[model samples]
Target: MESFGIVKAKKNNKIFVEFTRESACGESCESCSAKCAESEKELFEFPNTLSADVGDVVKIKTRDRSILSYKFIVYGIPLILFMFTITLSYYLMSKMFMKNIELMSLIMGIISLFISYLIIKGIDHKFQKTNKGDIFLEKM
Candidate 1:
């Protein structure tokens, strides 16, 4: 079975889709990892597809008991933490030393942001090799 969804938001280049429980997947299913311990109301973000914009409807095919895509987890968490730590470290160090904290924080934040972008882009490239959805987008 599959799920039909509508793109609700786009942030940092990722497309978020809102899928209802009444779709083919049903309101109660043991197939979804997110649903196994939570409610059926779900939002999925495809970090790769850029062809569709916000408000576009999408279709996603799911196999019973399959895991939600791990592209985000494997890549996103690390990138975010890296950026945050870098920025925070800069801020803290400058504050403790009574240096130009704001400027240092700003500069480090910008650099960390770029690093995060590169990390995410690399992960997207890696996902493209193994996942078809990472490379294509369509409107339903």
Candidate 2:
């Protein structure tokens, strides 16, 4: 999964950053979605946070190949749906209900955002269930 985060703080020449790994449960099945999902097979996470300086743009490199597969389903699907919902709601509500397109679009956008939050939360909960100390950040 490609994730971006700004350095929140720096100490001892080590950068402290916060990044989100998608829920692991999403990868437990054939239809799981969540960029952070992984197969039930043991996942190895490094033990230490990556070393980087505050405000530095750093890339995280992982040898895991499953990230790509999860990204397409986990992130891509909702992104596409969000766009589709916004467009469709605008057009349909405008014609069918005589509502202003902009207003309807705004409402739909908010709805999409809420849905996204729910999805992420669901993933988080699932990931927490597997509570393994192996997940870690490495600076690259």
Candidate 3:
């Protein structure tokens, strides 16, 4: 993905850029019917490949592949885990216990979902340490 922003600060090979939603909003405000609120500009630091100085307008690029993986991790995994756990727990509880199936399934599903959250948290911690989703400065 690509975005344009103004450089806000510079440190070594990294620069902070402030991006406004207007850059990505192509339609005229008056013509749009969607309820849109003006949002505050967001700032992000990216690896400075263009040697851009503070106040320079720069273009930033992030890999689409990286974004897909990130979205899957953030939304997909938890959903899959939750559904899988619910089904598996319900089936296992029905067969193994043969009594209080409903109560046991509900309990086990919740417990498994909590365990999935812990696993996701561990994955997030590892990714944070590696700076895995960093964007790159493409132009100035």
lDDT of 3 by residue, 27-111 (tens): 4476556635445599987777778889999877788887888789878877788778778878887778678787776777778
Worst 10 residues of 2 by lDDT: 39-48
Candidate 2, residues 1-140, lDDT tens digits: the string is 35455565676555555555556454445464554554232222222355556664444443344455446647876787788888888888877777577877878887987787688778768756674432345455
Q: By lDDT, who's the top model here? A: 3
Regions of model 2 farther than 4 Å from truth: 1-63, 69-74, 130-140
Clashes of 1: 1
- Residue pairs that clash (backbone atoms under 3 angstroms), model 2: 45-134, 50-139
Model 3 C-alpha RMSD to native: 4.1
Model 1: lowest-lDDT 10 consecutive positions: 62-71
Quote each prediction's TM-score. Answer: 0.39, 0.42, 0.66
**Candidate 3: clashing pairs of residues:** none
Per-prediction CA RMSD (Å): 10.6, 13.1, 4.1
Model 1 lDDT per residue over 18-92, tens place: 887663443566666665445356887787354778888888775433234454655666567667866787768
Model 2 TM-score, 2 decimals: 0.42
Best by TM-score: 3
